[model samples]
Target: MNNSKVFGSTLIIAGTTIGAGMLALPLASAGIGFTTSLIIMITLWALMAYTALLMIEVHQHADNSATLHTLAKQFLGKKGKWLASFAMMFLFYALCAAYIAGGGAQFAERIANFTGVEISGTNATLLFTLLVAGIVIIGTATVDKVNRVLFTIKVLMMAVVLTFLAPNVTESYLMSMPIEQGLVIAAIPVIFTSFGFHGSIPAIVNYLDGHTPSLRKAIVIGSAIPLIIYVFWQLVTLGVVNQATLIENQGLSALISTLATTVHQSNLGQTIGIFADLALLTSFLGVSLGLFEFLGDTMKQRGVSSSRLAVGLVTFLPPMGFALFYPQGFITALGYAAIALVVLAIFLPIMMVRKARAQSQLSHYQVAGGNLALAVTSGVGVLIVGAQLLITAGFLPALG
Candidate 1:
């Protein structure tokens, strides 16, 4: 395999994994304590990596051009296709809504800082939605280039924030109050959302032309980059800002504002805001592109036109409507997206892989640990689903 292919694919996976979800980490994990949150982050990273490999395993058995929807239909019948389609649509839509809500708020803040004029959240969200949707309508090749540029800027900005905040981290803040068991359980969905990269698995497989070793290497390395970043981020944020402050205020905006005050650096707020806006924009572009392509393909499969206008309308309208109605729901939207992710990325992959094995299908790349691995993956899925259910049923409090 060529070195460029491996490196490019790795970037794709990394770009897809690190996005709006990272912005919520400090706030979402704050209640759980930094140390415990780190452990959860590591566990979810490993679990997500396993599921991503399983996705690749299933993809290998299908045609190279096949998507998750197509694979589900082939292996799991119409019911499976419906499940995959709904999960993908729901997950991507939630993410798009979150990006709009978060990104628009940041844009408004930045503008207000400069002009001394406040932009309403609804107006900001509409503007950002139109801008991002326009970019998505241009198609993937253009979005791919823009994603690379944005991803590079995002990493650099993250490093800058980490560097500035490193000295301000207090030991007292790092080891803040212990969390209730229920709160920790409630954080599972947010943590799972942070490690999401399964959307890029099929893209990587096609990018590498099904080169298993290269694809495996790309997935492992790409996923690990975000894991390391999350650990350092949690340490910095939790070590600088108090738990009570995070829980009381909630969301990335509050975190950034608090960090600025805590560090006594007013400019830090603007820096972090810019960093966050870029993060959301990059993630939104990647996810929106994936959704657009998927919808376009499905439309074509059904003998629809799948024109740029039609694809763009289907892709951006629902998310825009959701964002318009619920402008301050970045973290809440992420939790919902995580639930859909569990269904499509976790449960569906396990079911498909088992069916593949039962049919005596073989792949050059199989997730090791056999039935035990499958069982463990299923258990992880159940844990996530149960956590969400408990939150919905009022047995556990929801994360902000």
Candidate 2:
């Protein structure tokens, strides 16, 4: 890939992966020992890569230009389309809402700590939403340009924190025993939320030369980048922080602040707070752009030429409302929403491939040697995560 192409690909990967989940990784991994978390990270990474490749299969095999909605419509008809749309709409927008609320809350909290300005989540959300909404309404090219900057900043800020925190990690933290299934059940949604590979498939496919081989390579390479970043970030974070402190903060920013206090007192603590705020804001900005683009593209495909306004509202209103009414629900709601997205992103793509195969449309590389094995592995992973999600949602009891 050309430097520009690689940069664009990496930006998509980074943008997809770095969202509300990045903020909560430590907390999610806390119950599962650091070592187990690392293990899960590897498992999820492979699973994500497999699914991304499968999505490429779907993209290639389709006879017409399509998005996930149309793919579901082709494979499973009206009902499947409805389910996919519901899940995508709920999951993507809810995440954007969570980002706005969480980012706003974090921003307000940090500013209050440093300055005496009594900022509320509602006010913060309003300001942030307006800024993002303006950029989104302008168009896709502008959004991509802005994302390049935000993504670079986010990665850099994370790098700084990792540098300071990695040395402090103890082997004992990484080697602790895994928690019971109850915690794992509760954590699946959180884990899924942090992994955002599914949403990028359509864009990657479009960017590719529209050939099976190139699309496959783009999706595989693209998804792999984030998986590595997630695993690396988890290692650096869990390594440096004390287990109990990690549990206590329940948010990455707070844990980093605590880390700073121990490392260099209140001075360093404030600095970490600012960096965390910037990183999260960048994440929020990227997601807002994506959400706008998704909605606009969906509407355009439906022949709605005036989707730009709808996209603006879709990006802005929900999060602003959540920030106003119930800022705290953002993260927990995001966890559940993530399960739905994973179903769409990971599981549905597999289903698309199977449907293609049944129709005899699946190409050779799609069902290539080892890919079926990867698919089976992905299926097993989904069952584990799905059962855990259902149990956590009270649809099933904890496993005996």
**Top candidate by TM-score:** 1
Q: Mind sharing the TM-score for model 2?
A: 0.84
How many residue pairs clash in each candidate at the backbone level?
Answer: 0, 1
Instruction: Please give, for residues 20-46, the per-residue lDDT of candidate 1 as tens digits.
Output: 898898877878888888888999999
Predict model 2's lDDT versus the native: 0.68
lDDT values, one for every candidate: 0.85, 0.68
Residue range with the least summed lDDT across 10 consecutive positions in model 1: 357-366
RMSD (Å) of each candidate, 1 decimal: 1.9, 3.8
Q: Which residue pairs show backbone clashes in model 1? A: none
TM-scores for all candidates: the values are: 0.94, 0.84
For model 1 the local lDDT of residue 83 reads 94
Error of 1 at 313 (Å): 3.0
Residue-wise C-alpha lDDT for candidate 2, range 256-338, written one tens digit per residue: 66677656533556656666666566666666776676677678889887657766886688767876686665556566566
